[model samples]
Target: MKTIYYLFGLVVMAVLTLVSCESKPSLQKYFVEKSQSNEFMAFDLGTDIIKAAGSDNLSADQEKALKAVRKLNILIFKSDSTDTNVVHYKEETTKVKSILKNGDYEELMRVGSGKEGASINMLGENDDIDEFVVFLRKDGVFGLIRVLGDEMTPTDVLTIMQLVEKSGVDMAQLQPALNQINGNKG
Candidate 1:
């Protein structure tokens, strides 16, 4: 009887191991760590964020992007330790419009309202700490991606946006689900 019980336990353990391994998503393959102005941050489909090196600040787009991600892995920058001042403002200029001139991703209609989506711009004029006001889809679906740096550099923001675009997420499918969550009548 003991032999039979031991055999059963071994089989259960093996099955459990296989089940756990299979639960990992295929998107995990895309994660990659890259060097940034802040320190080192990873980017990819599975990676939702890369924290500001030892600082509380995150670029506007980074914060918004993380919210939409179902799974996230963040690498904190370890080198830079300086603190900068964060300024908050609402402005109507596409200051970094040129960064997204390629226009690979098209904008979707807002789920509930037709109003233009809001955007965040964080500036550190005094070399304090950079911050950004982030834009998010109020319907909880999608929004414009924004990332702030010492200045809104063309490459940094574009890099983050491209990573998000390539994540194989079917935004069209996600929109309806998001609208349902928000209880959108429209």
Candidate 2:
């Protein structure tokens, strides 16, 4: 009887493990893999975004929204020249698009076609959001911004966008990518 009970416990544990394991490709896995390559530049804007994003002249709601954010994962594609860079840019862009389109994320907004466009996607329920993803593709360059938090509300995300639109994200963090993109354009 003891042996039978132990076997049953083991069986239940195995079943639970199998059920919890993720089988499909995930955006996070892609981020890790691409970050190692020379073609991509990755940055983590830590929890202290108030400092990084420049908290000057922000409203109460904006400040609150910014505080709700935990961190941001940014991945920008880099190339030496626009003429020669289309190969990897398109490839990585396609991978990101595929992940977002097929994954369980909900789309907030999308515009443009394959050559140039932008998209915003979110994961989790309406009230308790887990992560927000923003993808931008233009001028033969592309970038992915993953906003990670514990339980950000939809209003928080909207206010954050408003804050960014009004004040813009800290340019220091994005300067390198901007420079690289400009250089590639020529």
Question: Which lDDT tens digits does candidate 1 get at residues 1-186?
Answer: 999999999999999989888633211221231224222233322332433343245555665444433332322222122332111011111222222222322232222333235434433342332333343332222233323334434344444566556444445534543444454524
Best by TM-score: 2
Error of 1 at 52 (Å): 20
State the lDDT of candidate 2 residue by residue for 86-186, as single tens digits. 77776778788889999989999999985889999999998889999999988767889999987799899888777666555667766766766676532
Query: Which 10 successive residues of model 2 have the least lDDT summed?
Result: 46-55
Provide the clash count, candidate 2.
Answer: 0
TM-score of 2: 0.83
- Weakest lDDT window of 10 consecutive positions for candidate 1: 84-93
- Candidate 1 stretches with Cα past 4 Å from truth are 1-46, 49-116, 125-129, 136-154, 169-181, 184-186
Candidate no. 1 TM-score: 0.25
Candidate 2 regions exceeding 4 Å error are 51-64, 79-85, 165-168, 184-186
Inter-residue clash pairs, candidate 1: 61-146, 83-128, 84-128, 84-129, 85-128, 85-129, 120-133, 122-131, 122-132
